[model samples]
Target: MHPYDTIVSRDVDAFPLGEFLDYPRLMSVDWREEEPRMLSAFFTATGLPADGTTLEMDDRTSYYQLVRGSDRVDVPWGDEVSAQHSMLVALQRVFGASHSIRYLNHGCADTASFVVETNEDWRRLESANPHVRWFFTPIERLPDVFKSDIDELVRVGETYGGA
Candidate 1:
């Protein structure tokens, strides 16, 4: 499976995900500051940081949003075909549970469009306000060791003179 699709199938913790994504455009162009801020407050209330995070809005609803920097992106909240709210179950029907998975965004049928993170627990937010409407690919950290290797290469090139 694609990394984003896999993350949506499951979930990862909220951390710095600014490096691995694009604008996730195609949302309603009419946006308000409160929408992103409200979601940010909801997440911080739930103990996540103010940025680079994606999680469900609440338990009852299927809405999920990504609050990265000052922006937000809504993941597919429904099958867009049925009344299903739980995207995992919805997507599983389209992509199957285990083997024989398929592609994400084709010209028309985007099977992976139904993916979402099923890991949120609303107990953390004291008020637990359901945002009702809003939307991931969980962005995995580039391995920590990779940075040190890059630094080492830079040092070696400076000393021995060849990259």
Candidate 2:
């Protein structure tokens, strides 16, 4: 049996996720700010300092973002859409493939809802532009050391990074 089955036994089907993350209340975002300020907010909220971490953001394209630390954390949140997308990917990794997921896009929904919507967006983007970049595979391919470590999961602005 799959390891995730024990954790996701209660779930019946896949749906988009809704705010499944348990970030600190201190997290906030300023969409109007420039990239640097946005970056600063991300690190501050996540309690990570600059020159202490290496980071990456994978969305339409894979790009490197600034962070402090030797290990890597992937941050994809900056806007609501990206946050949704990030949440979906996170759920898939955590809950296992058999679990149902969804994303309501607007109002409150269960964690599964969030995952579906985010994934739907990602799929739409990829379909429109096959060249569109995505970090899902790369991140999914990461070794277990990075995937399971909460300490390695760093947050930035509205994004998150993992070892």
Best TM-score among the predictions, by candidate number: 2
lDDT of 2: 0.31
- Model 2: lDDT of residue 119: 46
Instruction: Name model 1 segments beyond 4 Å from true.
Output: 1-51, 56-62, 81-163
**Counting only residues 3 or more apart in sequence or on different chains, how many pairs clash (N, Cα, C under 3 Å) in candidate 1?**
4
Give the true-structure RMSD of model 1. 20.1
Residue runs of model 2 more than 4 Å from their true location after superposition:
1-25, 30-36, 46-48, 54-61, 65-68, 76-163
Q: How badly does each model clash, as a count of residue pairs?
A: 4, 36
RMSD of each: 20.1, 15.9
- By lDDT, the best candidate is 2
Model 2 weakest lDDT span, ten residues long? 154-163
Q: Write the per-residue lDDT of candidate 2 for residues 35-146, one digit (tens) a residue.
A: 3444454445334345543335645556334333433334445423344334334433432333323321222222211122234444564455432221112233322211
Q: Model 1 Cα displacement at 111 (Å)?
A: 10
